[model samples]
Structures are given as C-alpha cells and as structure tokens.
Target: MDPNEPIESADSTPESTTNKPQVPPIPTDGTPKKKYVRAVGPNLKKLLYVVFALLALLGANSGYLASIIAMQWYTGETFENFFYFCMFLGHVALGLLLIVPFIVFGVIHMRNAAGRRNRRAVNVGYALFAVSVAVLISGLLLVRAGGFDLKAPTVRSTVYWIHVACPLVAGWLYWLHRLAGPRIKWKVGISYGTVVGATIVGMV
Candidate 1:
C-alpha cells in the first residue's frame, strides 16, 4: 500500500457508510412469529393466464369477423355463398369454443375481485364483463331467432353492432384494469413472447 493512501479499517464497508436502519432481530424464545407465518395472499398467476387467454381469443375472433365484414362491405358479398357460409360457421365455432372458458374466467374474476383491495377497478371490469355477456346473449338469441342464419337484415344490422361494440368496450376496460393492477415480472413478457411465437408458427 502507498504511504499516501489512507489505511482502510476492516470494520468499515462502503455499504455501511449509507444511512440504513438496522432492523432488530425478533426474539426466538417460542414467540409466535406472525410476520414469518403470515399467508402471502392469493396467487394471481392462474387468473392472469385465463385473462390473457381470453384476450387472445377475443382478438382472434375480432380479426376474423372484421375481415369477413370488410370482405362483405368492400366486395358486396360477391364472394361465393359457400365462402360466406364457411366464415359464419367458423366464427360461430370459435365463439362456442371460447364461451365456456370465458364464463369460467368471468366467475374466477368475480371471486378475485371480491378479495381485491382496489374495488374501483374490480367493479369496472365486472360491469364491462356483464355488458359483454349481455351482448353475447342477445346475439345468440338473434341467431336462434333467424334459425342460425346470418342473411337476415336484423342479425346483420342490430345484433352485429352490439356484438362488435360490447367486446371492444369490455377489452378497453380490461386493459385499464390491467394497467391499474399490480405489476408483473419479466416472466409474463417472456410467456407472452413464447405464446405469440407458438401461435405464429401454428398459423403458418
């Protein structure tokens, strides 16, 4: 060591120089350690997975339905009757496949909301979900009224409008809820990346 250099003490550390509290060690004489034994609250991971899955399904349905609508609007349904029929069938099939899971997730969401400290977000989410469900039920009745027919003007005009609007509004509310909730870690981003990659590969 250079003579001009100040001698460093073994007791001193760079970390020790900072202003920090020295937490007192709790007594260990058979005392109840409530802090250590306390429950870590509800695990929200499954809820998040269910939510994102629903969002993905909603997005895919929106894409397919919007494309079909665009084809009809721009091309005047000049596409073959079989093509339109197939598209309608596909949309219904997707909806049917997703509805059960959607309802399940909604129930899970309500349960989670009950325990949520932030009731505002929970209430908003639930309200949006209810609106979405109402729109879906109305749309289903419209379908049944028309004998599973999309050719009817009422089904195309009125039911279609509600079907489009409700999901969009509900999705926006869900996005807001996500933003207001507790922040997730890098794992979520990684999982999303993997899912997207898998979806693209599957599509191709």
Candidate 2:
C-alpha cells in the first residue's frame, strides 16, 4: 500500500509467472510412434471367411480331380475336360475374383498376428500362404505345359507333381492354421459341407 515501496503485480508472482510444464515436442524424424490397430475388423474377418470357404470348394474340386479321377482315369478326354474345368473354376472364377483379396488380407492378418506375438499363427499362416502360392504357380505351369496333354513331358510331370503335392501339403497346413486361430464353428461346418458336396459333384 506504500506508494514508495512498489507493490508486486499479481502476474509477477512465481506461481503465476511459472511457465507451463512444456509438452515434449513430438519427434520430427520420419520414424512414427507405433500405433496398434485392431488386427482384423469384423467385416474383414467375414470377408476372409468367405475367401476361405471358396478356397475349400476349390481345394475339394482339385483334390477329387487329382486323387480319385485323374489318377484312376488319365484318359485324353478326361484330361481335356479337367483342364477346361480348372480353367473355369480356378483361373477364371475364384482366381480372378478372390486371389488379390486373399493374399492382401492374409498378409495383413499374418502381420497383425506377428505384431501380437502370436508366433505359431504367424508361422503357420506364412507357411500356408507360401504353399498356396506354390500351388498356384505350379498349376499355371502345368496348364502352360498343356495340362494332361503334356508337350514337355519332363517339365509337365515335374510341375504336375508339384501342383498336386503343394495342395496336399496346403490342406494339412490349412487345418493347422484353423486350429491355431479362433474357431468359427459354423463357418468350419459350412466349409466342410461345401468340400464334401463339391467332391461328390466332381465325382459325378
């Protein structure tokens, strides 16, 4: 209150004047802070289920053709018909429709599993994916070599065996993959039913 004794301004007090606890500046380097998102959304999971179901159908058809029909009756007409069937079922239909989505979503799922430290799932998923890719490539090679009408007998035989073998391996890996992940009982049932039905239809 003494005029000669200068009163401290309210704002000049240490508490009032103290700088706010500075927020640490976000790092400007290109490395972004890791952010975890939901690995598979509900919609994506459903789509993956559909993809898996179609894969089951294709697997059944191919398995039936190779094991029961092709091995038993390797006739020219049968081979030609099977080749056309594959072209329609595999190359034209499911391959064109679902292959990209399957690969993309499968990789994403695997990466998410890896991030979540689900090592077994990641490993099995990767193995399944690799085998599936091998099967696809070998099938293409087999077709290119004239399917059952093999022009290059050696190459066709080798590719034929590889195409056949990879799927059998993939079937096992697929089951393992299913075991490792959460089970959708209904989807599994439907897939199995589809496989059985497709196999029966293939027989006819």
Return the top candidate by TM-score: 2
Scored by Cα lDDT, where does model 1 land? 0.64
For model 1, the superposed segments whose C-alpha errors exceed 4 Å read: 1-58, 75-77, 80-83, 145-156, 182-204
Model 1 lDDT per residue over 73-177, tens place: 887855436645665666566666666766776776676466656778778878877986976675675565444766778656777678778877876786676
Q: Choose the strongest candidate by lDDT.
A: 2
Candidate 2 regions with alpha-carbon error over 4 angstroms? 1-36, 67-71, 74-92, 145-150, 184-191, 194-203
Query: Lowest-lDDT window of 10 residues in candidate 1?
Result: 34-43
Worst 10 residues of 2 by lDDT: 141-150
Q: Tell me each candidate's TM-score.
A: 0.57, 0.62
* lDDT for each residue of candidate 2 in 1-204, tens digit (9 for 90 to 100): 677997778667575447667679889897988887666878778878888777766755555555545644765344446655754456436544556777778777776667767678668888998988887667655554334545777978898788768877987897787786667487767878776776656765
Q: What value does the lDDT take at residue 37 in candidate 1?
A: 18
